[model samples]
Target: MPAVIVNIQGPYTERDRKLYAFLVHAVWDELGVKRIHELPVARINKVFEEHHSDTSQGWIWESAKRLAMTSVEWAQVEGEDRLHGIAHLFSYAATHEAARADGVLKFEFPAGLIPVLKEPRRFARLRIHFLIALSGKYAVTLYEILESVANLRNPVLEIELTKLRQWLKVPEDKLDRYVDLKRFVLEPGIRQINMNPEGAGFSAQMEALKSGKAVERIRFVIQKLDTRVALEKQIKPRLEPPVPPPVEPMSAFGILLSTRTYEKAKQAAPDFDIYGLEAEWRDWIKGKPRPNDPDAAFVGFCRKRQRRMEVG
Candidate 1:
């Protein structure tokens, strides 16, 4: 199986991750296996329309730019020997060809990655449709990581805490509290994976094992909806839009605010304009690194603001 690692921040947004999967599916499933390196111009809407109808022509070019700009670690694991290299997601990509007004993208597989795709000796049969269907970066990543081992008879995959963070690309400085880890990463990701019928359609669970009071490892237990169907379903490959995550309330600056944060803000600063304070809080947090629980952070800020008003 091939291993891919990308920095989770910056252009590696949820949309970009799905686009990456879309590109892979286009190459492996649509483009002829013989033409393993070059991808013919394919309509971005054909792949992305169901998910975002308002997807603009500019986005295709911009995404192509990001792909050309960002580098990813590519590795293929064989029994004892390992192959590793770094390259831009695309060796070359052209999405802004004036000759083609249609919103389409064409790209070449990075050279280091071409050999692995040509004839994969050991590979997981990852469906491009299901991968894009899964929501969130963590869910998409977790599904891919878990599917690699799904072939094992009733597998219970367990990893130490540190390794899981590395795989999920959770910044080491962020999501430090185990409760925060569970709330922000583990549960949400698992819910996204288990929520879709068009997806893997298998139930997954995470159990955090503690050493004294500290979380030491996470154990993922995957249960097949139908052992046969879960492992071997050859639905005609088609990308289907997933049920998107619920829209969270937005701050005045268009930043998303969790419901808990909103409610606490209302309580913390009844006489104050909550969204305005949220905007102020967000700005103040810009240069400062923040903890995992953003709701708590915002609440604390509001309390300080209230105190300042009383003292002043």
Candidate 2:
């Protein structure tokens, strides 16, 4: 079965709230390790696989696993007013299994297909290349190659200007800062220029050269190149998925209960705590009198009569 990826949002029901809570607890147990199946997320994983299939052992499976492992990252998109949203990464095998067991699948991903995942070890230096190819950007070819070397933490990998032109099929003069900006998509954290150490303080030089002062064209070009290169390094590493925020208490119930018309309760029980109110509501749920209230006798009688349909 081929894998599929999808996303979901939430103002979840009682059952969903409980299930999401349980899944979160499970995910915390499985951090920083492979074999994502062993995590608490497995329950939701099972739900996903039921809609997908696990029968394949080819590149599709690898892709499916990558999609699944990163599936939990949907939490990054959750908003303050939104209770929850889900993203699904499942295979045909898993989805079929789920349909056989549960009868129907409710959620569908916005993207209909999952990206093919590359073998981690086999992609030691070619990871960025694979991303560029997957994204179908021919212009990104040499840029990705350089980025791959940069990501290896190899500080000495240098491409000659002529070699870079031959490799990228672009003019030497046209080779610009976009190449460096591409690095942020892959590495996201590195900052500094490797090719020109003396060019570190070039931004001010560019500003000073911008007055159309025919004083020095060659110096201006160098300064412009340095400024653009700095901008690229400054922007690349931010391409990774954002860090998920710390989990906070849900405010939906608070907002909903606050807006409900409990005018009498507000006046009669001015300091009525919600938990206390719920406890009271549960106890009085079975047509029982609310304890210690003079009005409890009448409320209980009315409730009992309603149950018997005697008044109607």
Candidate 3:
């Protein structure tokens, strides 16, 4: 639930938000300090499984590439000094063959942005699990801002409409009118956050400040949920290994291809006829020495076959 200061753009897809959240959590220990971190693909895949339920190795790899390419703008103003720049989430490298083989992702934080990411007295301790369930970017943004001030002695936070829109990264043309903004963005986001059991353990409502019949600023009233009720609802079941469902007996060919290898092959050669490719792979490997790791060998065969097909 630690917070990291980030300047992100609007219209973030669900996967992108999840990836961003993961990155924030991954670098929590090193936040505020210039340091590189090693994040294993397996750990990231575990989070993907919890949030997305699909953790194919190829999909994970592709997602990591996408996350690495995402750019964000950072700006800080300290009295007479002003700093601003754009950078990707992190710089990536495999470092070693063993690291690549094991699917380790190395991330180097930008030195200039370390100060913002470091420990700060005022920051949002966002509950990642709740954020995962929220589909709208507005909901996530509002939840973070409200959660940051939820524990303050006075639970009322006020901000101008323009600043709120900026912080939420709302597009300029979208929700231009106060009524439209309240009806579309504010109402739905507040409703979603309040409905989520793990969302900051608070319910939020907004009061509009009117200037001569025109809404000027908005105030958020955040009320914390009862401690006992919050604790009871937050209890989560311990994670355990998934039990394989019973299946019919496999054919000879099916038995030869382990589940892991078959999945890898499917991902690697989605366009190729899997049965035909399997037959070809089987025939090609017939006279060869048995591979130490059959799954890896099968994946390699699928990749090579895919390349050949692309060339042909």
Ranking by lDDT: 3, 1, 2
Query: Which regions in candidate 2 have their CA more than 4 angstroms from the true location?
Result: 1-138, 151-153, 171-312
For residues 1-312, write the lDDT of model 2, one tens digit per residue: 111112322222222322222222233212223232222223343433332334222322233333344332121222444233334433222233433332322222223221211111112222111121122222233223333333232223343333333433343355354444335321231122223222222211111122354221111111223433443355446424344435532211111111122333334443323223432343232222223442343234334433464434
Tens-place lDDT digits, model 3, residues 224-304: 766423332333231122243254322212113443455678789776544345545544454345566666877888888
Top model by lDDT, which number? Answer: 3
Root mean square deviation (Cα) for candidate 2: 22.9
Q: Model 2 residue 87 lDDT?
A: 46
After TM-score superposition, the amount by which residue 2's alpha carbon in candidate 3 deviates from its true location, in angstroms, is: 15
Compose the digit string of candidate 1's lDDT tens values, residues 58-147: 665666677677666656677887867677766676654552435346677666665543333112244445565566777777776666
Computed on alpha carbons, the lDDT of every model, listed in order, comes to 0.59, 0.29, 0.61
Residue 205 displacement (Å), model 3: 1.6
Off by over 4 Å in 3: 1-12, 32-34, 53-88, 91-102, 119-124, 197-199, 226-312
- Total clashes, candidate 1? 0
